[model samples]
Target chain A: MRKIGKQEIEDMAVGAALLGTGGGGDPYIGKLMALQAIEEYGEVTLLEVDEVPDDALVVPSSMMGAPTVMLEKAPSGEEAISAFKQLEEYLGKKIFGTFPIEAGGVNSMLPFALAARLGLPVIDVDGMGRAFPELQMVTFYLDGISATPAIIADEKGNTALLSTIDNVWTERIARAATIQMGGSVMNAMYSMNGKNLKDSGITNILKLEEEIGKSIRLAKENNVNPIEKVLKTVGGFELFKGKVSDINRKTETGFARGVATFEGLYENKGETLQLRFQNEHLIAQTENRLLCVTPDLIAVLDAETGLPITTEGIRYGARCVVIGIPCHPKWRTEKGIATVGPKYFGYEVDYVPVEDLAKKGVTL
Target chain B: MRKIGKQEIEDMAVGAALLGTGGGGDPYIGKLMALQAIEEYGEVTLLEVDEVPDDALVVPSSMMGAPTVMLEKAPSGEEAISAFKQLEEYLGKKIFGTFPIEAGGVNSMLPFALAARLGLPVIDVDGMGRAFPELQMVTFYLDGISATPAIIADEKGNTALLSTIDNVWTERIARAATIQMGGSVMNAMYSMNGKNLKDSGITNILKLEEEIGKSIRLAKENNVNPIEKVLKTVGGFELFKGKVSDINRKTETGFARGVATFEGLYENKGETLQLRFQNEHLIAQTENRLLCVTPDLIAVLDAETGLPITTEGIRYGARCVVIGIPCHPKWRTEKGIATVGPKYFGYEVDYVPVEDLAKKGVTL
Candidate 1:
């Protein structure tokens, strides 16, 4: 186990934002929350998945709701603790450790904030190697892990401990509740033992996020293009470099649902790319080619700073590079594809690996 | 304590439906559920609020959703038991008894159905002497009793145990969840000790309902006008005797909302009356006069049989008698009026007691 200090949190937030693929909340807000918690409670211990005993219970710390709502009303930290406490009380077991449910700006950093305050270790593994919009889009769900007895607590001191028949039901009910509870709520769900985590979870996600963040930071000092360094670190293929043209977004049914259009720049002029999202980027396509789809990672990096821009942060004139990376092998399975693939998101497209799509150059 | 058999269940269902003020669920369905449970599990014990120990835990059994939805998707009985079991587990105490949260056909009978299955006593009391649409429109809320830690369970075996800052939040969150959980779910909420029930609840509500039911049934045998007998039994006034001219209703936002128009017959032949409702009837008025408004009870009964007709049961050209009864004295208080008054239901009128309105004849 290694201790995670402020520097680790800062780097992790940048990396997590990239992997978040334009969802999982804003990195600036997430970074501030983690930095503040670490400042007050000191460094938190980061434990590898194997460090936890097989029988010890572990829960992921995260939030559910439209990221737009979370921007205006950040969690007060108490909601996360309240959720954990309620889950423990209901399960009749003390949580051994906490971890990120997904790699997002807020989700990835939240574990550290909670662990620092509670004096618990932050597990290195995450259910998703990259972020997905819905709660059931996790490898744990693919492996049949139940997301209930899950607790969701609002900043207003309201909480609901849900026990659902399946993880999908958990997402449906919890999403509805999250809307009513001021459009955002902290969640302590997907509680499981270490064996399930080691077997199903994407291990060393935090390490990868830190490395991605470091690569971007070092590229600036070395006077090189940060986007190239970021793409190399994440093993991602550059889809398009473009300037934002037209973006339309609206918060509806507890989701930031909209599409962003980009005018191709530099190497790929005279082309238009469309990125559609429901909380996270679900599809990225150019005029005659399917660049990437869900179960694949699609991130937008600032043309200058190489910092990841969330869906909410994409502006009318911003210049950016879009990239796609292959998802974890778990998400490539038939069950995972059925659970979160393009068809599940209403895209009518068949499942194709990002690597395959990248190699083929263009497939409509 | 007394034993509640199938006969009592039948009578109470009729009475409870009337008290539901055209909102609570259909009596036929509620009666069938209670009678079937009684048939299998034997008689349920009925206890006066005073009979319960001061510190013993008691939760009310009810359902929250549009009655229209409950009609299409009847609960499987397992949902109610699941809700109670979850609540008991969360509280870490055996529930000493169960009661109705409101005086509605389904709300009143659900307690008996649950009590029979669990062999628990049914408390002879309820939060609302008459039904209101929203969860917080109960005396328990006025008296500062919270509705959480509450449990809501669906027929598909999903449950959510909610804890909120107040009853209103509980309603908001649970209502949203109920919509997602197939539009209806059984609820175990407003848990309190015996003392609190005695202090805040409307006592002898079941006894009153049974007496009203018996009066209606006896009227047929006595060859009497059942409306007169029913009015005398409940200390209610005849607001209008009319044939239904028009009726409109649609279930929206988890509530059956509509307006029923009546063309007066006999002594009131020249006048037309409009009754508006959200779950329960909230207002009854003529163009020239206000007859009754919530929290006073407004019930529509068959003019010939004196059996109550729910808002959903009202049909064009059906002859009916609209009656108004004074609410419990507790609901006349300032807080009670604010909680379930005419103004609360969006009617721009002051609350006048049904007795006063009847004595004055017409005040527009």
Candidate 2:
């Protein structure tokens, strides 16, 4: 097991924000929170799913709601532990460990803070290798794990536990609660045994975050392109390099969804790309065709600092580079495609692997 | 203590509907459901607060959401029990009895139904002697009793446990859940011991319903004014006796709020009166003066059958009699006025006791 300290938390925030694809809420505040937690509680232990005992109760959790709202009404840090303790009390069992529900955005750092506070180890894997908008959009859900019997808690010491007919209902019910609880809440759910996590979890997510962060840092030191380094280290594709020229944002059904148009720079001059999002960046499009679609990774990073720009923070003048990575093998299956494919997001086209799209030059 | 049989359920629905003041949702379905449970599990026992053991766990329950939705999507009859059982499991103890959270519409009968299913007794008392729209509008809340740790369940066997700072947060969180769970849900909350109920409850509400029903029935048989009989029985006042000339309804913030206008009939011919409501009849008015307001009762009953008309069932052309009952002495307190008064419902005028208005004779 590895110990995640302040430095590791910082690096993971950078990497997770990149993987956030412009959603999953803002990571800056979450990073600060985690740093404070580490300062108070020392290092957090990280355990692989296989290393945990078979009887261990592992809970995966994240913050649910509009990322922009998180910036305005910050979490009290106690919200997560309140939800966790409520679930523990209700189930009449101790939670053996905590883990990230997804590997992207603020969620990826919340568990670290939670682990430090609770004095528990965090599982080395995540439910989703990257973030998706809805609570049900997770690899564990796709693998047949239930999301019910979940606990929701707000800053005001209010907590709710849910056991829905399905994960979809879990998302629907929890979203409403989150909205009513001032548009943000911490959720602890999908209480599975260690054995189940080993079977369904996206393994090596922490390691992947580390590699992505390390690669970017090294590239920066060497005066090389951070986007190229991120792509090479994670086997991702550099989709576009551009300046954000136009953007549109609207909240629909309790989610912030919009499009960000980027004007290409350097060799790709005069070309434009559009990124569509609902919490998470869902689709990347060229004028004529789709460049990439989730559960494939779409990361938007600052051209200079190598820092990631959250969707809520994406303004009209920021320079950014877009990168795409192949989803985990599990998410490439028929059911996975059905859950988070282009069509699932209301796009007309079928899924085209990001690697295939990256080979063609911007010949136009 | 007494056992409430099928006949009592029937009578209580009638009286409860009168007290609902056109809001508590349709009582017909709940009445039928209670009858069915009585057939299956025999008559449910009813316990007075004073008769219970101090340590016995007492849970109050009701349905939350738009009553109109409950009409289209019939309950599975297992929703309340599911929540109850989940609470039992969570508390790690057996709940000795159940009670109505409010003496409004369907809530008045749901406890009987749930009791029959769970082999538990229904308490003779409730948190509210009559219904108000919001969850926190109960006497339990007004008396400083917390609404959590609460449980919410859907027909599909899903359950949620909530722990809020106060009853207001509980209502806010649960209302959102109700809306998402197809606009209605069964909630079991305010789990207290017998002593707590003795302190915060509106005692003998079931007996009050029984008295109201018997009074209306006797009035109908004797060919006397049923509204007058109701007033005498409950120590109420005749707010207006008229023909329903105009009615308007609109859903706001998840509660059906509207106005019902009545043209005077009989001895009070040629006068006009208006009854305003949000879930329940909250205001009684003449052309220029306010007659009564909540938590005082403002019931509208059919002129002939004396059957109460729910707010959702109020129409443009039904002849009706409006009766106003004095609020419980508890509700006469300053805090109670703040909790459920004309001002609380966004009215311009202050609250006036019903008897005072009835004495002045609808003077021009």
Candidate 3:
């Protein structure tokens, strides 16, 4: 195990925002929260998944709701502790460690904030290698892990402990309650033993996020193009370079749902790109080609700084590079595709690997 | 203490419906559920509020949703038991008895259904002497009794255990989850010790309901007009006699909200009565005069048989008699009125006791 100091947190936030794919909340806010916690409580220990005993219980600490709401009403830190305490009380056991449920600006950094205060280790594993909008869109869910016996606590001192028949039901009920609880809540869910985590989780996610962050940070000093460095680090393919033309967004049913349109620049001047999202970027397409779809990670990066821009941060005139990375292998399975593929998100496209689509110019 | 059999269940259902004030669920369905439970589990024991020991734990059994939805999706007995079992586990104490949270057909009789199955005593007490739409509109709320550590369970085996800052948050979160869970769910909330029940609850509500039911049933045998007997038994006043003219209802946001209009008949000819409700009747008015308003009870009954008709049961041409009864003295307090008053429900009229309104002929 190693300590996660302020520098690690700062780099991780940048990388986490990249992996968040335009959802998971603002990285700046997430960084401030973690930085503040570590400032007060000192550095938190970071444990590899295998460091936890087979029987020791681990839970992921994350937030659920529209990212826009979270921006205005940042958590006060107490809610996360309250959720963990409530879950422990109900489960009749102490949590051994905590981890990010998904790789988002807020979600990826939240565990560190919580771990610092609670003195719990931050595990290196995560449920999703990249972010998805709904709670059940995780590799753990594909492997049949239950999300119930879940606790969601709001900043207002209100909480709801849900026990649902399936992970989907948990999402439906929890999402509704989240909206009523002021559009955001801290969740202590998917409590499982180390054995289950090692079997189903995407391991070394934090390491990869930190590496991605470090690559972006050092690019300027090293006299290398930051976007090119990021692309090389993540093994991602450049889909398009464009200037934002328009964005249509609205917060509805506890989700930030919208589409962003881009006018291609430089190498692909005539093409128009459309990116659709529900909390996270789910689809990216150009006029005649399907660039990428869900179960694939799509991220928007500032062309010069290589810093990821969240869906809410996309400005009308911003120039950006859109890239796609293949999701974890677990999401390529038939069951995984059914859970979060294009069809599940209401797109009619069939499942196709981003690598294959990048190689052969798949027509929409 | 006494044994509550099928006969008592049948009588209590009618009385509960009248007290529901056209908002509680249908008495027929409530009677059937209690009767079926009694048939299988044998009679449930009824305990007086004073009979319960001060330290004994008690919880109320009820349902929250649009009444229209409950009609289509009746709860399986398993949901109620699941809710109770979950709550008991959370509190780490055995519940001594169960009581009704409110005086509605389904709310009142649900206690007996659950008590019989669990072999627990049914307490003859309720938080509301008359039904109100929101969970916090009760005497218990006015007395500062908490509704938390509450559980709401759906027939599909999903349950939510909520602990909120206050009862109002409990209602808001639970109602949203209920809608997601399937529009209706059984609730186990407002848990308190027996002493709190004695102090805050309306005692002997079951006995009074049974009497009302018995009076209606034996009216023909006693050779008296059922309406007159009902008025005498409950000390209520006739507000209007009318034939139903129009009803505009829609179930939205987990509440059955609408208005029903009536064309006057007999002594009330040429007058039009308008009744507005959200789960329970909240107001009644004529063009120039205000007839009744909550927290006073406004019930609609069959003009001939004196049987109560639920908001969902009101038909376009049925002859009916609207009656008004003074709520328990507890509900007349400043807090109680503010909790369920006309203003709270978005009505502009000031609250006047039904008796005062009846005697002075209050203008709109």
Candidate 4:
């Protein structure tokens, strides 16, 4: 796993920001916060999920709310760690480690900040390995875990404990709270013992993020398409390259939900692709056929810069490239599909690997 | 605390269905499944939150999904217990008791079914004490608990664990999977030790639900407005009595989000009110003024029958009474307001207690 230093964090943020596309929220504030943390606490140590002891207490830290609000509002950086400590006390156990919830935007660095301050190791893995809109969307959820007794702490040292019936209620309540807290709140959730992690957790997602980030940096240095490099690293497929022709967006329930239509480029010329986003891309379609849906990663990037464009950043006339990556193999199982497939997103589309879709010459 | 029998389950479901206000989804399937489990397992024992040891492991059981689909596709009944067992093994600890995530419909009885079979006591307290749409919208959340390592078990014996960055992701991933699992999945989440329960949980919510249910029954028999009785029990303020004039809804991200407009009656005549819902009534507004929002309890009932209305069941022409109950005083604190008030739900309005709103001389 890559051991990220203060220097690497800036590069990683640049890369993470690129992957965030426009909607993962601004990585600048989070980047600054994490860098400050690293400077104060020294470089963060990254460990694989399995490296955790059977009894280790692992917690994830993140910022919740609209990306737009985060840009305008600076975080106090005390909430996540405070929430973590509160939960640790609630469980009557000491926390051993911390980790990111995803590999996108501000969240990608939240764990880093917590781990640094707590003097604990941060896992290279993330629950999602990517970003998703809701609280329950993670590989950990697929592993049958709860995100309860979650501590949501605002910048003002005010903290609340949310124990819900399910993960979604936590989201519903937390989302509202985050908005009220001025569109952002640092949260510590999904606390689990190491025994549970050994069986259910995905290992080394932070390493993956670093790898993806470094590869993009390398691609830029070599003057190559960072998209191609990412696809190769993740074994993803190039779905389509195009210029954004139309964009539609609206903030619902404090989240950016919208659609983008792409006018195909290069070999994909004359074909059109429509993509939908809710924090992260939910679906990609070419005319009548739905191409890739949730569980699988549908990412849109600037053709020139190879930076990811989030729904919040999507604008008319932006030239972009749409790429589809295969989700974790586990997500392809019948159980996995039921948990995160396009059908889960209200699309009637059946599950199909992005690579297979590419091989079929069905452009999306 | 009430030791509920199968008969009480039915009445609770009926009452919960009303409180759901056309949105909690039909609790019919969840009810039937819980009934079958209870019949097979026998009667469940009840325990107050304070009765347990501080270290006791308490797990919550419920169904997560679109309530609309719940009516069409029923649960298999095997999942809740299965999920509970999986969590137990993962934690390497036996659960001391079971509890409902909320005290409405099937979720109210889910813990009882499991409790009977597992030979454990069912906690009389629930997270919300009422029904809410998302997984994390619970008093426990306000108390600073996390809902990670949540076990989501499908009917087909497939169970997944999710530990998200936050409760919101937990909901997003779990809901997506629930939809893929054919619309409904039995979930046991927000497992916590008793110490956390006492610190912030809404203790005795199940008992309160039972009392409310029984009081409603007694009130009906006594020719009293059961709605008024409920209001008195919770010390809530009557907001308005009206007939639903318009309902606007759309299914987005698998949730039914919409608004219902009401034409006031009696002293509220000529004044109009609108109730917003997303699995639960989130806000009530009268043009420029806001009446109530989450963390506080908003219940809609049949004016004539004094029955609650589910979020999905809101319909035009239905005569209803909208009542606003103050949430636990804890929710009104700055921390609490940051966690559950209207501002959290994306409104710019300040939080005003239902009692205070009533004292303002607003017509109801």
Inter-residue clash pairs, candidate 1: B23-B279
Candidate 2 residue spans exceeding 4 A from truth: A304-306, A315-319, A360-364, B361-364
Two-way lDDT contest, 2 vs 4, winner: 2
Lowest-sum lDDT 10-residue window in model 2 chain A: A355-364
What does the lDDT read for residue A220 in candidate 1?
87
What would the per-residue lDDT of candidate 1 be over residues A1-364, giving only the tens digit for each residue? 9999888887888999999989877767777888999999999999998899999999999988766577789888999999999889778899999999998667888888889899999999999898888899899998999999899999999999899999999999999999899988999999999999999899999999998888888898898999888888888999889999999999875578899999999987999999999888989988899899888999998989998998989999999999999899898889989988989888988877888888896557
Instruction: Please identify which of the two predictions, 1 or 2, would achieve the higher lDDT against the true structure.
Output: 1
- The list of candidate 1 runs beyond 4 A from truth reads none
What CAPRI class is candidate 4? incorrect
Candidate achieving the largest lDDT? 3
| Candidate 3 displacement at residue A60 in angstroms | 1.0
Query: TM-score (0 to 1) of chain B, per candidate?
Result: 0.97, 0.95, 0.96, 0.90
DockQ of each: 0.94, 0.82, 0.94, 0.04
How accurate locally is residue A80 in candidate 1, as Cα lDDT from 0 to 100?
A: 96
Model 4, A1-364: lDDT tens digits are 4477976786677656644534566677788888889989888888876677888888888888765666666776677767787788768898888877767678887777777788888776676656666778777777878887777766755555555656766676566555545567787788888877766655655556666777777899999988888777657766777888998888775567778888888887887888887667878887855667677787777787776666766778888887777776767778778876777777767777777776774533
TM-score of each: 0.96, 0.94, 0.97, 0.54
How far residue B270's Cα lies from its native spot in candidate 2, in Å, is: 3.4
